[model samples]
Target: MPLRLVKRLARDWFLLGMLCAVVLAVLFPEFGASGGPMHADVVADVGIFAVFLLHGLGLPAAQLRAGVVTWRVHVVVQTFTFVVFPLLWWLGDAAVGRWLPSDVSLGLLYLCAVPSTISSSVAMTGAARGNVPAAIFNASLSSLLGIVLTPLIIGLFASATGQSLSMGEAVLKLATLLLLPLALGQLLRPLVGAWFARYRPYTNAFDRAMILLLVYASFCDSIASGAFSKYGAQVLGLAFLGAVLLLAIVLALTTRVARGLGFSKEDEIAVVFCGSKKTLASGVPMARLLFGANPALGLIVLPLMFYHQAQLLVCSLLAERYARRPAPPPGA
Candidate 1:
């Protein structure tokens, strides 16, 4: 590859790390599998707690408050994320679910029901010189809503499929694993917020590291349980294609809808970026909590992993293109 290509690829360190994690899981499943020497389950649980705590601690409350007045942008982004995306997956599943393993189909549905990403959505909106405050507000709100909405959405899917999911139990676990820690972090943020801000880079590193660890552990459990062996490469290939197509559809739809609503150029950029993306940070841990040690956990997260990387590559390019546009005339 050219040096420029190499540099670009290197910038996607999380993507590279994820691939390495899968490779490691495939080669030595025992090391990271649930009861393996690493005690991955305990580690993952603890890490999940810390992850949410840090999120609460770092949440920009003032910015979110500032952005709240832009209810129009929030509604559009949230609708695309929680409504249109899930409806697309449901229709897609109805058309093609028979060809895919049930787990993969469910994974795609889960992907749609999750929230818009936080850091990337804001970063991309800013890179594109869009409405950054609105992006931050909408993205953060999506994640918060996802805490209640994701499981409920999954429960609805479960009902449609005749699978039993205990909503009460799921809610309790979510509170303990996700909600409580987040609240506690927010409560404690006044004391530690400055500390966390000063060490923002380290906190971000921990966040990435936890995600990779969860990926490795989830794949290890799946491999050890013979999940991949049950489904051939063709299933995975189709799922990858589905992820790409889904992203494309959402991107086009969000852009069209933004324009149709007569949003300004900057608002349009925010809508497209914030509305089209999903968060792996929230998805992986949520999957683990939802699915537990089920053998199919790995397959269930496959679509999300694929979608995460796809959004990153596609949005990065799109953001750059938007950034290159000529500045609007003053007081247009």
Candidate 2:
């Protein structure tokens, strides 16, 4: 490749790493599958705990408090994440689910149901000179709410499909795996918060590494179980296209609705970024708990992985555009 092309690709190193993970899983499925010698599941569980603990410690209480007064902005962002996004997926699936593999369809719905991303949404909002505090609050609140709401949404869909989903069991596991660690971290924040602040880069790397491990393990299990053989490679293409369309729709709706609600430009930026994005950080770990050792877990998380990268690419450009706009007159 040309030098410029290599530099552009280097910027998406994480996405490239994810692709390498899938290839590894395909080639060496036994090493990372559920009963694999590597014992990936146990390692993933420990990593998940650490990731959320770091999240709790790093989140600044003052930023969350500052954003709390902007109730309307929160409402808009959360409504899109938990309500509108799912409805769109439901309608889209109703129209096309029969044509797609069941697992892929469910993956799209799950993608819609997960929480807004934390680091990227806040980073992009700040990049655009938007309401960073509100972005932080909404992103954080969305993750907390998703622990309950995502399972509930999945349960409802299971019932409608004549499949049994134990909402109680799912919620209990999530509370144990996710919420408990988070609360403990918050309790310990005063003690370790300074350490977390000083070592932010290390914590971020830890988070990314955990996610890549989860992805490898998920695909390993799926491949070992012959899950991907049921569908052709075109299924991957479909998932990517679905992610693009879902993102485009949500972005347009959020931008227009924010304007319609008479939000200032900064608030609109927060609403658009927070509402349109979903977090792989939360989604991958949640999928492991929600689906257990189901062979379809890889297919299930495929859309989320695709959407994660797509949002980063699209929002990076959108943030640049917003950043280029003229600043508003002081105090007016």
Candidate 3:
């Protein structure tokens, strides 16, 4: 393509980083696989904990203290995040399971069960001149809710499929690897929150680095275990298409619902971004804990890997479009 277009595409740095990570994983899986020299899982767990700790530190205390009293907005965003998306995916699985590999289907279902993203949702909301505070609140709330909810949703899914779930184990993993660190960070926020918030850009970059490490390590383990061997080019393409279709459906639904509910333009933007995005940062760790060396993990996370990149590109374009809109007449 043209130079400018390449640069534009490259602006989604994390997306590009993820692509590079995949290649490295495929070629040199030993470093990140189980019992590898690097102790990848332990490192990833620490990174996740630290990233969320910074998230807790950097969060705007006043906004969170005010809380999500906008029950209408919170209800809609959380419902779509935790309920509508998963329900649709479950129904889709029933209707389309015959067409998809069982592993891919389960992965898609798991993708549906995760939380809304954190930084990107808020960042995109700000770029689009949306209600940034509301986006932050909703996205953070969704992450916290996901700690409790993703496991439950997946447990129900496993139960319905007559699959076993180690719920206690999953819960413990989440608490240690995700929640406790965040709680500790929040507790210490009084002491360091200001500094973290002042250097927010740097902290956010660190968070992205941790995410890249986690994604790379997980894919490395899967590749090492031959988890990707069953997926041919055709299967990979199908997973990509499935993820795109799901993202489109959620985007369209959120847009229509926000408009129909008579939300202001700003709130609509928050709804569109927060309600439609999913967190790769949270999903990878949760999958590791849930699946625990299941060889199908590479396939299970395939849809999410595709969907995460797709959402970044799609939302960036939408944010640009929103930025270009004429401003409303001041004070009407």
Candidate 4:
């Protein structure tokens, strides 16, 4: 294969490269500084707009409706993703406080505050023959709520991490960046839905491209802010371990609790995947917006970066395993 083809292949498969590029750009932002703070904010806004547009393209309305109507599945997934997960994070923080670095601790706290992974939740729910609709509703709802909840959770619990936004400012930004596009998407749903159905593959590709850009920008900001110098590999390693442990605990609890609540295999899988995963794509951007000025925000996002990859891998395996599990004995 030609070298150009190799490069293209690498780009398609390489999440780390996009992340590093953004990190580099942020590290030496002077390469072209026309936008300044206003530009940075605009990029953030546009990126969010693009995100909502992409999500709208594949909003899964039918599945969402089905999930919402199935009150049992909806309740179980939401309770785990929103309520149980946050409580577990708090407990984990207390249990592991002494071992966690201040910045890593803050990152973990922020991770706890984020909503579940939307696309992944849908995909995993499908794989496990779970309530995909419930997964969609719960996951999307989590993201919607996350806009307000993330900032509040961070401000309340992770004060020492030095990342705080006034409730009013956070709400305004979220309304403008996220909710507005969502509303527009809803209004244009017929058109967007048709486009998505006709060119599903391309729509998904475009969405990934937009996320790739945001990922690059946010990571660049981290590098530019001198975050790399402040935090070492040892600290990062600890954060990775903590993130894995946190995810594992959530996964196990959600599955167990869902089963106890009389949820089927499908609902159990949805709960585990949605409740266990955090949005690296969304969280990084939010961190930049909320803690852009705080130097520590860079450190705070490091664990999330690790957690994002780990969750994807672990859940991929678990989703498969659950899919293959034999049906429970009748009336057992």
10 residues in a row with least lDDT, candidate 2: 156-165
Clashing pairs in 1: none
- Candidate 4 per-residue lDDT over residues 182-230, each given as its tens digit: 7777667786678668887776666666666555555555555666557
In model 1, what lDDT does residue 133 have?
A: 95
Displacement of the residue 308 alpha carbon in candidate 4, Å:
1.8
RMSD of 4: 4.9
Better of 1 and 4 by lDDT: 1
* Candidate 3 error regions (>4 Å): 1-6, 159-163
Model 2: residue 114 alpha-carbon error in angstroms: 0.5
Q: Estimated TM-score per prediction?
A: 0.96, 0.96, 0.93, 0.84
Better of 3 and 4 by TM-score: 3
User: Per-residue lDDT of 1-332 in model 1, one digit per residue for the tens?
Assistant: 25744576789889899999999999999999989999988998998998999889978999999898878999999999999998998888889877777777878888888888999999999999999999999999998899889998888875544355678987887889999988998899889899999999999999999999999999999999998998879768977999999999999999999999999999999999999999999899988888875777888889999999888878888998999999989997
Across 1-332, the per-residue lDDT of candidate 3 in tens digits comes to 25644677778788888888889899999997777988976886678778778866766668865546666777889999999998988888788777877777778888899999988899999999998878989999999999989988888886544356678988888888778877888899999887877897888888888877777777787788776776667768878988999999999999999999999888899999999999887787777767756666667788998999889878888998898988889996
The RMSD of every model to the true structure, in order and in angstroms, is 1.8, 2.0, 2.1, 4.9
The lDDT, on a scale of 0 to 1, for candidate 3 is: 0.83
Q: Which of the predicted structures, 1 or 3, would earn the higher TM-score when compared with the native? A: 1
Which digits, one per residue and each the tens of the lDDT, describe model 2 over residues 74-136?
Answer: 999999999998899888977877787778888888898899999999999999999999999
lDDT of each: 0.89, 0.89, 0.83, 0.70
